[model samples]
Target: MDDIYIILVASLFSISCGLLGSFLILRRMAMVGDAISHAVLPGIVIAFLISGSRDSFEMIIGAALLGLITSFLIEFFHKKANLQTDAAIGVTFTWLFALGIILISVFAGQVDLDQECVLYGEIAYVPLDLWITDAGLNMGPKALYVSAFILAAVIIFLSFGYRYLHITTFDSAFAASIGISIGLWHYLLMGMVSMTTVAAFDSVGAILVVALFVVPAATSYLLTRKLKSMLLMTVLLSFLNSFLGYYLASTINGSISGAIASTSGVFFLLAFLFSPIDGIWIKAIKRNFDKSKNTSKTKFNKIFKE
Candidate 1:
């Protein structure tokens, strides 16, 4: 069914982004995903110009390369130029994004890329974009295959590099002292993020990709402290976001991507207010209960003294 296909693709993309996003959040480089998403625009344009086609594979290859360069520039500025990390990210993404706009303007006739499609995406159209065999067999939506492949790749990357990523993320100084190449792992992580971002473009677009990258992970962070638990929760939340978002969009006749993104935010708000670990409402209730208990104890002491 088209509904199933759309939700499946969204869930896969959300899980991939959330898996990588967990680490990015811990590393305080969550915005790097945002940077790469925007910075890859020029790559898409360039790929279109050279290939003279809007093939997904060519666009991904080009965008992935630009994403890597964006990562490098951010790191280079932060480390070598001694700029703050935020500053580095700001400088690199804006410059590249502006350049992409310039290129689009200059070659308006050649490039068929629409800014709205790039930013907002059209997940509702996934079922229509089927991959057909040469013999005329329908292999389902191409977005489904791409999302599944990316999700598998992300799982493999995290499984193998968990130790290095965990150590480097939480204790960079200790990791460096132990001779673990933090920079190498950092770039590798960034590379994976780049690939995932590019792959999700057709399914969710850049804006929703960034939301999926950061929201589920962040929401899980509030629910748990253990890295493994957080990851599991993130995956669960990703699925919930996708399913709920789809139904919500159908009910309202709205954009699926926008609805999914809004659903992620709603979930995040719930976690922020209700998470047992450190939720604001829970903390407030605990504080008031403690105050009441202390007051009762003081009263009892006064009565006993009297």
Candidate 2:
């Protein structure tokens, strides 16, 4: 496919991932995104075995179902077995991913994938081998189109269900008491995360998928406290990083996914150091300013009293 189109699609995919990820971070379930991304390998492998190829629809369906299962397992262990949340996530994801790794190693000769491909996908090549139509005109790549629709779906869902999602993310118990099905919302959010991960795999690959999931949203969180604003900021940051990363990779003759991930890291670094609301530097500055203002107010009050 064309390089330009590939870049566009890749950026759109990142944007979609960032949208859902904003909520994940707000809900303090950021680690679950990481776990789901890793645990998806087994599902993809199983889907391939059943379908006998890397079919997009089938793979996504199978992968998303398995991702939900992984989340369910983590929840089960945490609630029922009383394990630490982190421990539950670690044990479950690692076990599943390890099984997938072993399966790949054993079936290396027969399988259509490789470790390198899984970790860092060829985003630059997605537009090259796209399905064409009778007109001979270049239709967009499937990954790009699929990601766009999914992103739109997520944005629409968040828009209409803003009230419910906001309440649930901030306080699930309260949301439930108020008539929201916290259970449905939780599953829906995680399901979207899984779907994004699977769609992103073909663009940035599996290991780096979390970059799309976490970094841009995190950077946005550092910049905004409001949910809708944060989601918008996340998408903007994600797309900017994607554009910069893709261009930089062209310059250095490097991997696109690595470039995008590194770009995201840079975004997080900037947000951490300079964001006006939650950044370390900004927080300190605000504190000092507040103290100076208070001192001034105290002197003025004493003068008035005198």
All-Cα superposition RMSD per candidate: 2.3, 2.5
lDDT of each: 0.91, 0.86
Instruction: Give the per-residue lDDT of model 2 (tens digit) for 97-195.
Output: 898888888877767878787878888877765657789876767666777877887788788878888899888889988889998889888888888
Q: Which one is best on lDDT?
A: 1
How close to the true structure is residue 96 of candidate 1, measured as C-alpha lDDT?
94
TM-score of candidate 1 to 2 decimals? 0.92
Residue clash pairs of candidate 1? none
Instruction: Give the poorly placed runs of model 2, Cα more than 4 Å off.
Output: 134-138, 292-306
Model 2: lowest-lDDT 10 consecutive positions: 124-133
lDDT of 1 by residue, 129-233 (tens): 889999999999988998999999999999999999999999999999999999889888987888888788767777788999999999999999999999999
True-vs-predicted CA distance for residue 231, candidate 2, Å: 1.1
Which consecutive 10 residues in model 1 have the weakest lDDT in total? 52-61
What is the TM-score of each predicted model, taking all chains together? 0.92, 0.91
- Per-residue error at 227 for model 2, in Å? 1.1
Clash counts for all predictions: 0, 2
